[model samples]
Target chain A: MVSEADSDEALMELVKSRDQDAYARLLDRHMGSIYAYIYRMCQHHNDADDLTQETFLRLWSRAATWKSGQVQLTTWLHRIAHNVCVDTFRRRGPDDYAEIDPDTVAVTDDVPDDDRRRAVHNAIANLPERQRTALVLCQLHGWSNKDAAEVLSVSVDALESLVARARRTLKRELSAYQREICT
Target chain B: MTADEFADLLDCYGTDSVAWPSSLRNEAVRYAQVSDEGRRLLAKSIAFDAMLADSTHVPVAFRLRARILERIATNESPAWWSWITQSMWRPALLAILPLVLGFVIGDMTSELDGDSTDASMFLAFTDLENFVELNESTATDD
Candidate 1:
């Protein structure tokens, strides 16, 4: 019975020893974030759910592989989630991704906020995979640029570039909505 | 910071001033405070950021925790012996077993044959000694 106050590293230590309670704790701590991250990436609840489970399963099985001093657990988990998404993308092929056209988004002021948000969601889901990932990590998830870069396996500069490009696209796509909301 | 520089910072680091690089944060805030265009861009960024944040309401993964816990419960790590028994090397060792046994058996048989060969050589040497002794005795008698 690991205490609730145990650090992620401490929980991971117990998980490495096949402690199910520690595994459960880590799951509760990370599963939502990982699931959301995957959901944002893949945009399919079923796939995101499966991928999140897969990510945690890897955490449970590969607990010993984690180097506590070298990398934070959240970064490591996100990295795993990133890889899982990549694998899914590879298997599903490029055509499976339903990229929503920016022009098709209802940018009119008369559109309801929910519809505008849906447009925003489609716009994000339609961004190039790397750009979307960078934006999701840095902007949506509130991860530091450096940490997000680590998860994306790119330099901080490259990650920043991805994020910048994503924001530019989003701003362009959502400019009308931005005006409407800001007014 | 110039308008383009300020917008770039917002684009890269986001609307949150705190999330901006420390060196740029104060300058960006100052620029937003002083410049009309900067303020407009900042406001737009803030609004866009709010939209982006609110765009996707991630629903709580229904029963995901229970499903994951169930999986963890079912998929216990294999024991140490299972690591060996489940490995490719198991088949490889099985394939080499006959050769290893043959080598050992052949070595034992060779050792037995070597002893017999040594005995035969000793018998042949003894026969030669006996023949020499008989010949010498016959010669002595002659």
Candidate 2:
């Protein structure tokens, strides 16, 4: 049995050699998270799909030049995904980000009760883009402040500020419920 | 404690500050223990954290998984085939087509020229004259 790390390196080697199995495995391992990330960023499924394909096509084309470095492959992929999302936002006029479907936006199932999780998910949807990405990376995805900063290409202090501002914003946004719930 | 003071505590609450002034920790604790408002705020913050902790997840759609994999497979199959074909045949083609077309056209013109013996050349000139006459007469008839 191959360890995941070993498998990842092997798959990357295969990917560099244009192996379909490797590409499929890589996609299988990451598609859901990648899709969710892109979906959150773009707020549209079709657009996410398009961006996902474009991301992979880029990876496929550039596979030959991929260097083994300090950054993990996941982080590399996230950077590419981030750039793709940014390009999409640039191409689509600022006002053209489609409104997220309530059902899709609130599809989280992390909480014991799905309904409550959905509520929190909806609240997350209201966060500004930087805050949303920071929150998703640090709070939801369990990334360390340093790791999240690396993924965002921000300073650790900057990421800390993003998370801090995000938490305060969330607190204020949910202040109405503070009285009833905390009472 | 004033909200400003309490807010500062909240910001530093998660940090591992070895240098966190003992005075600040005591003040925050005293506030949490005695002030109803502070207790309420702490509980609210805890709930907020829990909501975040318990909320986000990547929902895996099996159909979408299959579809993406299928797309990758289809895309790669064509590329793989092209790669294989290019590897096996491209050099051979590069070496062969120009020579082959050159040979074929050369052979064809040579055969035509060979077939044009003196007698046949004369026949060709007569045929051209006949074709011109026939076209002129047809135009006149029209």
Candidate 3:
């Protein structure tokens, strides 16, 4: 059976030409993944929904400037989501939530798991902005390190270093959990 | 690589979105052979990465696919402005320019004609002086 990914390139071509049908088709195809990614990144349903809409608005507005093969349109959307999340972070201020334990906070869409997932997410949330972004792109999203690096505008080696540091910090923070669960 | 170095690398292994290099694979295998502890660390890292990979959660409301598509459809369609700004503006400017030039040229020519009329009247007085000089010379000659 034909897949959505195959048609995405064609839809993008239509989008570039301002073909509303194609753009609509593109949205239909990719909106779920886009929304999911944004939701995960923001961990706020309202913000994710709003940011997803904003992301598409930007995609539509910049459609004319979109050049195929520069980046996958999905990656482009993620980059937009990344910026929106960062903007939200700045607007909400550094004191958005000080002294909160990442381990205790639950940001699930449905049934709540224990604090393990919460801890992972908290570790993600507490990361320095770039490391958090890099971790989200690489770890949470399952994007190739190269693709994540491309989205972040960093060399692969630099990206590796960021991931290393982020992981080390997470390992330290969640070490207690690891000992309980793994060892 | 030492145990500490292997542990650090394992911690970083699954965290990056980038593909693991073949060289890294070799390193992992080499480390695995040198120390069972390293292999065990790699197993833990891989398990953690798998958990992250499996953590995608799409919201049910995100099925606003229809609405999203409709938004893209209605909003991005080529509109009146595209043609008005991109296609029509320059030609419209070109078309209006000659009419503006015609009005300007007409005003300038009218002013020049008025000035020419004044200069011609002044030249007519000079012609009268020449005629009077001719008559005085003829009377003297007679």
Go through the candidates in order and give each one's C-alpha lDDT.
Answer: 0.86, 0.66, 0.70
Error of 2 at B66 (Å): 2.7
**Once superposed on the true structure, which residue ranges of model 1 sit more than 4 Å away at CA?**
A1-5, B81-142
C-alpha lDDT of candidate 1 relative to the true structure: 0.86
lDDT of 3 by residue, B52-103 (tens): 4444344665456556666766664456655454453758978999999999
DockQ, 0 to 1 scale, candidate 3: 0.30
Candidate 1 per-residue lDDT over residues A7-74, each given as its tens digit:
89888878877788988878887888999999888878898899999999888767767988899999
Candidates arranged by lDDT, highest first: 1, 3, 2
Q: What's the lDDT for residue B97 in model 1?
A: 97
TM-score of chain A of 1: 0.92
Global CA lDDT computed for model 3: 0.70
Clashing pairs in 2: none
> What lDDT tens digits, residue by residue, belong to model 1 across residues B33-111?
9999999998888888888888777877999899989998886756564345544577898999999999999998988
Q: Which candidate leads the pack in lDDT?
A: 1
Q: Which portions of model 3 show Cα errors greater than 4 Å?
A: A1-6, A102-112, B15-18, B50-58, B73-78, B83-142
Write one digit per residue (lDDT tens) for candidate 2, span B37-107. 77766676666666556455544444665665566566664666656453546678778989999999998
Q: Give residue B96's lDDT in candidate 3 (0 to 100).
A: 92
Better of 2 and 3 by TM-score: 3
Which parts of model 2 have CA positions greater than 4 angstroms off? A1-5, A43-50, A97-126, A178-180, B1-42, B53-58, B77-142
